[model samples]
Target: MTCGRPMFPGSTTEDQLHLIFKVIGTPTDDTWPGIIYSEEFRGYNFPHYRPDPLINHAPRLDAEGLSLLAEFLQVGPTAQHFLMVAISEAVFESFGAAVQRLSDLSSLFEVSGISLHKNPGLRSSATLTGRSRQGR
Candidate 1:
């Protein structure tokens, strides 16, 4: 029932995130507001995470190839669960494609449990999207 939360930093993030620190190659501000993540201590913060190289897939990687990628991600000794890239689609048909692959992706993530969600103030079921509910 939780809408996976919107990252919503808007254009500011798009602009500021890649900005090099005037003094250094990194940013002067430790945090950039509107960076979407699960961290508390609400304030300015930038993307501070990196995928485990051993556990990550290069862009455009396919599902089966992602299996070994996920394994490497879960390979650390600690029981900590790391990150998974968020994937979104535009319409109901696209959503259908996402649901179809959820299993294989879950297997790659090495967990049986997952929940598909969307932004709040939106329908929980795919049936309510766009023109369907609008009668347009």
Candidate 2:
């Protein structure tokens, strides 16, 4: 859903594809570098449609909110703005407080020598069982 309405609501895949194109339109080198060279994007047989503005698609969002959302929704992994930049740009009234709190927490975590990296097997049942047994 763009805001609340379905962006590509259809019974068939074709209809959905059409709607998808309508919303995003075509991605060019300027908008998305190297997209034209991707296997899926190359030699495609589809109708070209222009992109509808984010506001037009999601009328409920204000310009600032939409700008932030657009940054987050970039197609390329590197195209998206950094979290810090996005937050600063959005500039919530409590941003300073939030950043200070985060910094304090990070310092505490660093002093404790606890790595922030997530354990790859965290979701496995075996890991949970082992941890539970250790607690006993």
Candidate 3:
């Protein structure tokens, strides 16, 4: 996607996180609600970083693409699911339909006893299964 240019090409986990923070900004409790609960992150004081606009990092992306990329880069399952619904609606119907589609999908998932937040792997499995069934 980056044309072989790795975005945050750091050699170690900490270094990678720092690079990500430099661009995406440091995660806050609001942005990353459960980060403080992680054993690896607990008590570690990460330096504050203000978000650098994506254009500063990926100059090739246009405004619309950057907007979509920002949504795709969101931190949690709920955000990611919303991004997926938004993208699907944008592609298959009108963007105005996204809210309704999201509601519909949420209700469908609830009825099916599928929780994307609890088992993210099911999303991958379902996607793969759908692709296979489509003979794609």
> lDDT of all predictions, in order shown?
0.33, 0.53, 0.59
Q: In candidate 2, what are the lDDT values of residues 75-100, reduced to their tens digit?
A: 55565345446545523322233432
TM-score quality measure for candidate 1: 0.17
lDDT of 3 by residue, 71-129 (tens): 76676446867765655644323223323445534642332222223225433221212
Residues 70-126 of candidate 1: C-alpha lDDT, one tens digit per residue = 432342222133323233223223333433355533632232223243545544422
Worst 10 residues of 2 by lDDT: 124-133
Q: Sort all candidates by TM-score, best to worst.
A: 3, 2, 1
Stretches of model 2 off by over 4 angstroms after superposition: 5-18, 82-136
lDDT minimum window of 10 residues, candidate 1: 20-29
lDDT of 2 at 50: 77
TM-score of each: 0.17, 0.47, 0.57
Candidate 2, residue 21: Cα displacement in angstroms equals: 3.1
The window of 10 residues in a row where model 3 has the poorest summed lDDT is 124-133
Q: Which prediction has the highest lDDT against the true structure?
A: 3
Candidate 3 lDDT: 0.59
Q: Which candidate do you rate higher for lDDT, 1 or 2?
A: 2
